[model samples]
Target: MLSQSELLQFSRHIILPEIDIQGQEAIKSSHVLIIGLGGLGSPAAMYLAAAGVGEMTVVDNDLVETSNLQRQIIHQTNTVGKSKTESARAAIESLSPYTKVNTISEKASREVLGQFNSSNLTLALDCTDNFESRFLINEWSVANQIPLVSATAVAFSGQLAVFNRKQEDACYHCLYSNMDLPEGDCTDQGILSPVVGTMGSLQATEALKLILELEQPNGSFLLKYESLKTTFQKFKVPKDPNCSVCS
Candidate 1:
């Protein structure tokens, strides 16, 4: 049950038949783990925390750089030289003090992935730009039988997908077959600010949907967008028969 203040704070959601007080409670009880604090992670964290997701754990070792101001909108000029996780935490704290923001001021690796337990985490979001962290999150998601949402944006395009271990859908490795692509960071290849914002917001929406249990969206669905238009396409993301990790 919501207090008068909570009911009023979430009146818009309470009015929705799909998200009544009960659903809002679900949101208030869910715990989300977000990897990376750059482009995709920024908006995703902002919206989820503001929407009252009970807890958020953000991991990132990098520090805020002046160049990051373009697409990494979470950091301010004064926040430069600060750890990305710290900067992100301050933003979440201000927007939704109700939501607990756990800051991992270090980069996420296979070693640190154990910090997230199945019991502790309700969902995981991969907003990391690199392939290694992305694969690590996917492997951990499968091993722990947790759901993972991942989004990527470079240049003018972006892709979003949900990997559900409970349902045994295609993990991130299965979709791309393997992570053998050339390394490219936003520093080298510029990304449009709006593109990052759009994809990150969608990631938050999918995370909320999973937390609320409103509907099990197609895990295989992919939203590919460019500057001109956006399209949601559904197709099979089959599990790799010879997958080393999640087979």
Candidate 2:
């Protein structure tokens, strides 16, 4: 039940027809796992906390660098030497005291993933920059039948997708399995700050909808954002019968 203070704090959300009191309650009860606390994870975690997700487990091993301030909005100038997980937890707490945040100041290791309480974890958000982290999160989500929201941004472009193991959705491996693509890093390639912010916000939106079951979980989609052209393209992705991860 929402307390009087919570009701007032989330009055805008409660009044929305799509997200009424029941949905607000659902949001209040949901727990989310956020992997990575850099460019993409920053806004995703911030918005999720602001939206009143009951609990969030944030994982990241990196410390804040001076370069991160350009896009990693969750961490401030003073937190440059601090752990990303701790900085993110502080930011989320500042945004919503009602939202509980668990900080894991380590890489998303098997041990870390193993500790997640499956029953309490409503969704996992993949905000990591590399393919390996994304793949691991996808594998974990598929194995546990948990929903996953994955987003990436580099060089003025970004992509967002949601993979639900319970539904006939395309897993990340299904889409890029045979494709040979060079690994790109934000530091090496240079990324527009807002590009990641845009993708992160969309990730948060998709995670919330998936948690509430607000949208039909049909096939998945890969949404591409081109900042140069100011165009958004969405391509439908089907689950591959031969997908080694989700098959």
**Candidate number achieving the greatest TM-score relative to the actual structure:** 2
| Model 2 Cα lDDT, one tens digit per residue, 1-247 | 9999999999999999999989999999999999999998999999999999999999999999999999999999989999999888888998999999998998897788877656868889999878887788788888888888899899999999877666577898998887896577788999999999999999999998987788754778889999999999988888899999998
lDDT of 2 at 36: 94
Error of 1 at 63 (Å): 1.0
TM-score of candidate 1 on Cα atoms, chains taken together: 0.93
lDDT of each: 0.85, 0.89
Highest lDDT scorer: 2
lDDT, residue 134, candidate 2? 79
In terms of lDDT, model 1 sits at 0.85
Model 1 ranges off by over 4 Å: 178-183, 229-232
Q: Taking the tens digit of each residue's C-alpha lDDT, what string does model 1 give over 1-247?
A: 5668777888899899999889999999999999988999999999998888889999999999998889888888999999999999999998887889888888888777897778989999999888877878888899998888899988877888887675556787887766567557666887889998889999999999888887775554556777656555556577777887788
TM-score of every prediction relative to native = 0.93, 0.97
